[model samples]
Target: MSKASETAPSNLADIDSSAWSELETAAVSQQSGFRYVNLCSVDAEAKPQARMVVLRGADRSSRVLEFHTDTRSPKWLELSANPHVTVLGFCAQTRLQFRLQGMVELHGSGSDLAKAAWVRLPTWSRMTYSGGPPGDERAFEAINESVPSRLADEAEGEAHFGLLIFRVRMLDWFQLRRQDNRRALFTYDETGALAACRWLNP
Candidate 1:
C-alpha cells in the first residue's frame, strides 16, 4: 500500500472535520470527474433500487444535497413514500467512494429551489425535461425516441421540470487499496454541527 493509504484513518470520526469539506469539494469539482452519483431508494417491502443521476448542488454549510429528476419517475414515488435514501459516488482516479444516507424533500415544479436548479442546467441537459412523463408505457417499435429538443430560451418556462433536495444526516468515505482498505464515517448532530468521525475496516 502507498504511504498515504497506510496512514489513512479506518474510523470515520478520525477523519478531520475539514475532510467533509474536501469530500464535498471533490463531489462538485467539474475537473474531478465525479459529477454523477448513484441514488438508492427503497420500496415498501424494503426492496432497494438504484439509478445514476447528475449532481445538481450541495450546501456544505447546511449539509444539503440536491439533484434533479422528473417528478413522474417511479423513484420519485418511492422517495415520497420513504424519505430515507442513500447516495453513492466513486472516483476511479482517486480510488475513493462516498456513501451518503439522508432524508429527502421533493420540491414541486415551480418552487424557488426548482427554479434555481433549472436555471443552472445547460440546454443539452434540459432536453431530458422534454420527455413526456418519465417511465410511461408506450407501444413497441416507437419511433422518434429522442427527447424533444428546445431552444435555450424556452427551457425556463417548462413546467414539468422539478428539483429534489436531500438533507444528509450521515456520510461514509471509503478509500480502496490492494492491502488494508480505509473507511471513515461522519454524521451531523441534531443542531447540524459536525460530530466526531471514526474509522472502520474496509
Candidate 2:
C-alpha cells in the first residue's frame, strides 16, 4: 500500500510483474482503499457518458470487472443499445494509470448475480434504489423524502437494483516516474484469453 517512490523496485522484471499484480490486488483488497474507476459509454445519440463506479469484483483470467447501478438509470438504456464501455482509473500514489476497454452486461432483479449482490447491500445503500426513476421531474425539494427510510422497504428497493459485468477486451497500463515512464497494452482475444502484450513509448 505504500505509494512512496522509495519502495518501487529497480528491476524491469519486477516492474513488469507489478503492473498486473497491482490490478489483481486492487480487485480483491478494498482495504488498500483504491477501487474507484471511471466508466464511459455512448448514449442513444452516440454522445459520450462517463461516471465513477466502484470495482465490486474482478476476475483477471476471465477479464471481467463488476459494478452496480440503478436499473432505472439512463446508462442501462445506453448499454442496451451498445454494450461496449471503457474504464479509466489512476492511482496517484503509485503513479499508475489504467485504461480498460470492454463490453458490459447488466443483471437485474431475477438473475443470480443481481440477486446475490442485492442481498449483500447494507440497508442504507439499498434505500438508494427506492427513489423515483433517475432524471424524473421532481416537484418537491425534500431530499429526505426521496428514499424509503424503513428496512421493510428493502425488498421493494431490490426491484431497481442492478449489477453490471464488464468483460475487458483490452487494458492499457502506464507507470509514471520522475526518471522514466513505462506503458504497456494487453489485448484479449475473442476467447477472453490474453492475445497480446506490447510495450509502448511513454
Candidate 3:
C-alpha cells in the first residue's frame, strides 16, 4: 500500500486537507499519480472532450489549480467557449479518487500569467509549443526537425503557450478499501471558502 493509504484521513476536515495537500504535492512531483490529470470540457457540438494535462500549480487556500497548454489546441478552444470543466485524477497505489468541478480562466500569450508560466518552463518542455499546431498532420521528416535552441527560437514557442487557471467549486473525494469504501463531497463558495461538506455512501 502507498503511504497515502496507510495514513488515510479519518475525518471530513482532514480528508479535505489531505486532498489539497496531495494535489499540491502532485503539482511539483512528476512521479506522483495525480501529476497528470484528465481535464474535461464541452465542445461546440455539446460533446464532452477529455484530455490529460500536467498539474503545474495547486493552491489550497484559493482552491485553484493551474495547467499549461498550447493556445492552438482543441481543448483551448473548447474551454474558451465553455469555461466549465471537470478535473479528475486517481491514484492506483493509494486507492483514492478526486473529481473536481471548476471553471477555467484562460491566460493568453500576452497575459502576464502566461508569460510567467512560460518563463518557468524548461527548454525541452518549451520545445513542444514551437512545432505546428497540435493535432496537425506532419510528415515524418518534419517531425524530426531540430528543437528550439536559440533564445529567439524559444521566444516563438512562448507565443503559443497559455496558462489555465481553474477555480474549483466542488470536490468529490473517494477512497476504496477491501472491506468498505468511503466518500465525501465538499462545496466551496465563490470566495473559495468551504460552504458545505457531506459524507456519502460508497
Candidates' C-alpha lDDT = 0.74, 0.79, 0.92
TM-score of each: 0.81, 0.85, 0.95
Index of the highest-lDDT prediction: 3
Can you write out model 2's per-residue Cα lDDT over 1-202, one digit (the tens) per residue? 3355557755544554565566677766775334888999999998999998878877666777888898889998899889999999898888778898989998988899999988877777788787579889876766645444576578778988899999888888777788667787778886677777777888
**In candidate 1, where is summed lDDT lowest over 10 consecutive residues?**
10-19
- C-alpha lDDT of residue 84 in model 3: 99
Query: Which residue pairs collide in model 3, if any?
Result: none
Q: Model 3: residues >4 Å from true position, as ranges? A: 1-3
What candidate 2 gets wrong by more than 4 Å, as runs, is 1-20, 27-33, 146-149
Each candidate structure's count of clashing pairs: 13, 0, 0
C-alpha RMSD by candidate, in order: 3.3, 2.9, 1.3
The 10 consecutive residues of candidate 2 with the worst lDDT sum are: 10-19
Q: 1-202 in candidate 1: lDDT tens per residue?
A: 5565556554444464434555567556776535787999998788999999877676777788778888778888899899899999887766778898889999867788787777777776666666457778766656545444367425543576767888888888888899667777788875557775667667
